[model samples]
Target: MAALMIQGCGSDVGKSVLVAGLCRLFTNRGYRVRPFKPQNMSNNAAVTEPDEQGRRGEIGRAQALQAMACRTPLSVHMNPVLLKPQSDVGAQLIVRGQIEASYQAMAYQTRKATLLDLVLDSFRRLEEEADLVLVEGAGSPAEINLRQGDIANMGFALAAQVPVVLVGDIDRGHVIAALVGAKAVLEAEDAGAIRGFIINKFRGDPELFDQGRREIVSRTGWPDMGLVPWLAAARSLPAEDAVVLRGAADGMRQRVRIAVPILRHIANFDDFDPLQAEPDVDLIYVAPGQPLPADSDLVILPGSKATLSDLAFIRAQGWDIDLKAHVRRGGCVLGICGGFQILGRTVADPDGIEGRAGSALGLGLLEIDTILGGDKVLEPCRGRIVDGQAVYEGFEMHIGRTTGEALNRPLLIREDGSGDGAVSADGRVSGCYVHRLFDAGTARAALLAKLGGASEGVDHRVAVDLALDEIAAVLETQLDIAALARLAGLKDIPT
Candidate 1:
């Protein structure tokens, strides 16, 4: 019956990282612990663990990290509402472990009460089963405007009667102001629910806060948990969002270098995880500030929730200019999902399905036009590269329908007529809706040749499972497990 909520002073203030730390902390103590976020507005999400009845829910990466910390099977009930960005003002809503529908912020706000009902239902289920549920709040509850349908923070706190531990990022200059403002922003009733506070990501000496800590406790009347310094290896946790999942390619090949054009809304970029399993290849992320390396063996344009918008940004950065030059120089390019959409001639959002103003131009690399399709395609795929340069199979999730004369040039072939990706003639560049091409041995080998990535002898799944277990082990090492049991109020139960 013990539950604690973690709410941040603001977005990207390390709330996700804090829950990840606590997940390990509580799990090490031998108590069963889980993570919860009543509603999460993130494109990053995890496929839930199957229950006895084989049920599935839409838990975000935060919960996945917690489950990994506990070394437990992930559960669907951990997150009840998952909102994936489809456009600037619109989101695709997933409630109680399933896709509900896409809605604009205005429409979503109107249905906030209904969303809260779903959140409460998920919490009740977790309360019935787990020893601890560490809930994570989205954005800030201090924004009184959104609190009306607020299942994410204070509203959930009040409904579940869960104790909260507000976390402030000292790395940000507004730590004191954020803490004080939080106390002032909430109604007295909501503010009283915060039982304690923690300062995260401190760089200097911990004692520097000796005086500051006292002042905060005196001002907010909340106890101090601890000022936690940054954990350098925090990246070991399973990445719920693909953007945070990259590491240098582990290939042993000395000459291999790959450039990844970091899409603004990259989704499931974890498909590249095994590339990091090798020891030889160097992985470099190509962001807005830098140009794609012409000398690099390959360039990758990853998936995106908003392909058209990202395409515009890519053009703004003049990356499209660089991409054309890289292609002419014989450097290979790979596109996935929205990346696939962008490679086409144009992207049409006739219905404003993706929340953009209207139809938009694409990167015009692949000779195709992608129409925004209402039906979302989600399925694991398998394929064979008919041509010499490419072949792989993975999952596909997108809202665009691509049409092209060259679309029939499949990179891989399965027993089924179509598998995952398609290849064009000459095969210098190719595209797919799949996320993890590195997962396939044949595929990886082919791509390594193009990207100069080195390969490991291990199968992709074995490597992935090993990496996941390794991350889970970190939770055991850093967390105060026994302390968590006491905090969860489950210290007396038989292990």
Candidate 2:
């Protein structure tokens, strides 16, 4: 089986987007393509397609999007080692789609070496089925200090014997130095694994950087595979890292201003992408030390990796006060997953599932209470929006059970007649476990209409698909796809 890996000089250097574009580019050329990442560290996750025994697993949301680009079903094997951060120095480890254990930063370094076999096993399985697998390296291979047991980048590439194409972000400046310096710092064998380089997010005339590109090639002895211009379509896709959240919100005011307090450990933040895509909706990610916008039409408490911790974070930012005042002003509030748990009267983490064994007072916006400790619910579901005619479909990926008087009024009614979330008596406050709820056009439109904003009739899923194609078209012209295929040892790509 053929495969190639895309490694970047650093995080957010467009490695994920490049692999995604290539997946679509190759898939469009009639090849059976697949996306693979030996390891991923992110809170943004997605449930994979069910197995023969009807079991679903989780992978990074970026891998899920890349799977869509390949026109294939998501598989946990695509991202075998997922690190969902619970704190700055700790993360919950997932291996082969199942929660393994939690580890601190230093502790995980020792443990990662043991998982190489598992990562390789998953890669071999994917090789059995795909014509070509496009592997995405996490962070960067340039961090050679972590090189010993690193299954994420160079370690995985060398073990899998996959040739890599280095990607550098020109938009960040120092493009030539970044690319050449990486080759300089890497061990000789590791440097040999890199076959070529691509300069990403170039803004100006391509010719303006021609000499710069030559300098990188001259220094590193690697071919210049491509120089990709900044892609506006990338904004339509889900971001994998929270680092992107810095400077995330635009300064412009819009018809409907929705404020989202950026939780320290936010998860599945892509849930609001559809709303952000709407022209009339301005989704603001309120940072710490900043107050939630007073003129906001809605305040959405986003999904959190650590519910109890983030609930305290809300209080720390004084957003708890802002939220109550917003509700008093007749503004709407919505929460999903951990955010849903935070809306209730109390959140109990008895088994210490997400830190200490204790309970804390919730925001008291809803009558419900949540107990964190249960088998995680991971399944695709569809239902009617309670109190509205709009039908919605999304996945449920959360751990815990909620109950309260608010259950008397559900936010959604699953097709199986089971309720999924709580609705406050006044209806201004609500919460649910379903992620991607707004992807449903009717539901999005209904919610926006209630917020006094027009939806513009955009089908978010279709728009994402179009965005993938748009990205692929740009890559097809900008990048040397034929050279990449050749590097992967494929016979000439189908014209």
Candidate 3:
């Protein structure tokens, strides 16, 4: 078995996307490939396949997408340690697909060393079943302050004996300095782990950067793996970080305008990827301090990692008033998981699972109340719009239970005859706990038709699959795939 790790000079340097492209590139070349991330920090997560006991776990959404690139089922081992941030200073820690505990930033720094064995164990398990494992490193190895108990970057690469390739985002500028600076700051052993360096997101003619490429190699003594151009296909893929949400809403006028008020702790924002991909629909993310657009046909309340906290944030931003006004103006309103809870009359946190043990008044859009304490529900399910034939499949991953009179007018009916969400008495407001609710073409089309627009009827899953292949094809021509294979001890791959 062979493995290679992709690390970056800093965050948002495209390490995850590069590893994903490589995973598909190698998998297309007839290799059994798997993806591994020693640790990940993001609220965007996906449910993995169930085990013998019918228990499903969650992993970082990027790892889940990489698994799709490899044509493999999702597994918890793909990401051993996941930190879902609930606040600025702390996060809820997940290990081996289960909630281990919550820890503050300072406390987690000291506690990471003990999980090295589990990270390695998961990597080896993937190696046992595949010819190659594409590993992704979080943040960067140049963070010497975090080098003490790091399990994500140099620490995991050195321990797993995996060759590393450093990636720098040229589009962010200082490509040469970023690559050389990483080598300069890293300790000797950590620096030696990097086998080569790749320049990513180059936006001009390749020949224009020849001198720059040579300078990076001349300074770092690492081989120039490749200079990849700006990959337009990447825009079609789901982004796992909240940073991407900034400036995401292009203000282009279209047939339908849907506005989502960006919550402070928004989670699973990618649930709207399908809607965003539609050419006739304009999906806008209303950031803090910005008023929700009055002209929008639909106002969507997105999922949040910290419900009560973001609920309070909503009120602070005066969006709660905007929503009430929207409903009064006869505009449509739809809420997602945490947003669904927020649409209710009350949201209570009895055990303090998310933050403080308290309760907050909801928006009162739906006649429901939610209590945020319980065994999290993480399972795949199939359902259809209540009294409609637009069937769809999605998953439920939440830690609260909601109930009330609105459920009597369910928005969706599961295949098992259970109601999934609620509908308003006026039929203008609705909410559900289902993530990826719009992935199905029929489902998206049905919802858009109600908003006085027509959907192109694109299947989001199929589009993502095609996008992965498009990225792999680009990497095939722009990258040194053969050299990357050689670095991973894979010598037989055709050039």
Clashing pairs in 2: none
- Which candidate tops lDDT? 3
Give, for candidate 1, the lowest lDDT window spanning 10 residues: 244-253
List, residue by residue over 401-439, the lDDT tens digit for candidate 1.
888865877556664765445555667777877766677
**lDDT computed for candidate 3:** 0.92
The residue-level lDDT of candidate 3 at 172 comes to 85
**Cα lDDT tens digits for candidate 2, 1-495:** 889999999999999999999999999998899999999999999999875567788999999999999999999899999999999899999876778778999999999999999899999999999899999998888898999998999999999999999999999999888999999899999999999999999997899999998899899999999899999999999888888888766669988999888999999999989998998989898888899999999999999989999999999889999999999999999999999999999999998877767999999999989998888888889998987778888898988899899988988999999887888888899999999999988999989888888997666888889999999999999998888898997776653
Best-to-worst ranking by TM-score: 3, 2, 1
Residue 141: error of model 3 in Å? 0.6
* lDDT at position 18, candidate 3: 89
Q: For model 3, name the residue pairs that clash.
A: none
Candidate 2 vs 3: which has more lDDT = 3
Query: What TM-score does candidate 1 reach?
Result: 0.81
Kindly list the per-residue Cα lDDT of model 3 for residues 118-176, writing each as its tens digit: 99999999999999999999998998999998899999999999999999999988878
TM-score leader: 3
